[model samples]
Target: MRTAIVVGAGIGGVATALGLGRAGWQVTVLERAPQLGEVGAGISVWPSAVKALQQLGVTGLEKASVVSAPAGMRRPNGQWVVKASALGLELPVMVHRAQLHELITSGFGSGVTVRTGVTVDGFADGAVRAGGEELRADLVVAADGLRSVVRDALYPRYAGPRYSGYAAYRGIADVELEDGGGETWGRGRRFGFARLIDGRYYWYATENRAAGAVGDVWSAFDQWHDPIPELLEATKPEAVLQNDIYDLPLPLVPFAQANVALLGDAAHAMTPNLGRGACTAMEDAAALVRHVTGPAAIPAALTSYDAERRPVATKLVRVSRNVGRVGQLDGRIAAAVRDGLLLTGGKVAGLLARRRSG
Candidate 1:
């Protein structure tokens, strides 16, 4: 039987393991954490990612259309920049990150073996050393994350994660709210929230700041419009999670080196501006299964996977970075210009929508 090793038990890593298992490949998942679980708050699963999740064996993900109501980009004072109905945006499946992780892990079969509390020290020539154990496999997947050990082994000299000059605060507010949440943008900061599948609200705030700076989520968003303050108030202070945003330098390439593949953040970590980070990783896992399940050998299949996914992921990384720059614009004049353009663009889009309907 074909054997594979997945570094990191993140959403991407687990999905890859499950998919490989379904493809009849035995998979060993290594995690430095002592237990298997996911942290963080809500995650937005776009339509494409929903399909990928379904393809990977998650079910009962029906989201009611009622959640897609009147909402749009707004200012700090709650002025609407662009309405959702006008944008005709596709609604994503909002879910708690832990719940989503559980769903994916449930798909794991006997062929998948998860070893937590195991640290992956490094790799060389396609062999991974984890927890003092030198491991070899038919394939090595670097889903480890931004500071991936496997990725360093494959491309030691490549520039890795670059800071986005912003940090994000994420949390789940157990309290109920009546608003159909959307993002509120202010100079150098932004806040967004959405109703999760489990009836709680997931909220996040981004601020332009130096990496590793201490933050007060409440102070950052307290002056914003309704529900922004409320969301933070409802959230436990300790439950608030913050991380400086970073992305791997683009051209996300050579996803496969020899028999090893760089998956998820290890390959294309991007700003959450478009919320495509995890979604794209899920897509990578799906694509891997598609190519590897065929008659082609592992290396050739991974080559096809890299060819198909690299371009798409690269484009997303670039766009997301640009969006982050705009979203986190700290200068008052620049932010005003950005909002004005977005409002004007939204009007034109609305006009086009009406014209097409007429």
Candidate 2:
């Protein structure tokens, strides 16, 4: 029986392990965290990732997540800027990041060993060095996220993850809002609120701030009208998760050596502009499962996986960066343009609607 080792045990790593285990490979997952959990507040799962869930026999995202088509943007006042019907194939769903992680981790059973608190430092041809142990495997998956150990050692020339010059503040609150999803744009910033799986409202705000800076979620956003203040006030300070958005430059070696491949943020780290980060990782895992299922040589399987994933991930990295510019638009002129776009009815939806179509 062929053995595969996956590093990280994150959404990407767990998904890859489940896919490979189901395809009859012995799998071992290494996670550095003491406990397998995520602190991120909320994530939007788009159709591309939903397809991956369906492929893995996962269903009822509405049960595990909050399902609401984005109701479009509005001003700080109670005026509608834009409205949109669910145009895409799958209605966008938002869920707590930890819940989604739990769903992915639950799929692993026998033949899938999960090791928490173990860090993978580097990898050679067909083996990984983790916790001073040299573990050999037929396949090594570098799904270790933005700071991928394998990526750093294997593709040194490839630029590492860079900050996108914006910080996001996210939290889930007990504010009693309507059961729909809504986003309101302010000067150089955006706030999104949605219902969660547990009947609570998940609220998030992004602003152009210094990398790694903790934001004043309430004081900074208090000027906004309506539920913004209420939601922020209702949210406990401890519940907020602050993140500095980061992304990797593209066109590097998505695959390395004969027995190693990269997946998810390890391969193409991108901003959460369209919430496609996890989705693309799921696609990579699925494509890998398909390619390696046949009796093809290890190199051939890796080639096929890279062929299917590189172009898409590259495009996403670039697209997410561009979208970040739009969402993080600053200055007087840019804010006016953003407010105007949201103020119009169909015009705002017409232009911004296609952004998530990918």
The TM-scores of all predictions, comma-separated, are 0.97, 0.91
| Model 1 residue 248 CA deviation in Å | 0.9
Residue ranges of candidate 2 with Cα displaced over 4 Å: 59-62, 86-90, 341-345, 348-358
Give per-model CA RMSD. Answer: 1.6, 3.3
Per-structure clash totals for the candidates: 0, 0
Residue 29, candidate 1: alpha-carbon lDDT: 96
Q: Which 10 residues in a row give candidate 2 its minimum summed lDDT?
A: 82-91
Cα lDDT tens digits for candidate 2, 49-111: 888876764545667886765576776675777665632334678788888888777777797
Q: Write down the lDDT of every candidate, Cα atoms only.
A: 0.87, 0.80
Which residue pairs clash in candidate 2?
none
- Candidate 2 Cα deviation (angstroms), residue 246: 0.8
User: Taking the tens digit of each residue's C-alpha lDDT, what string does model 1 give over 227-261?
Assistant: 88888888999888999999989767589977888
* Maximum-lDDT candidate: 1
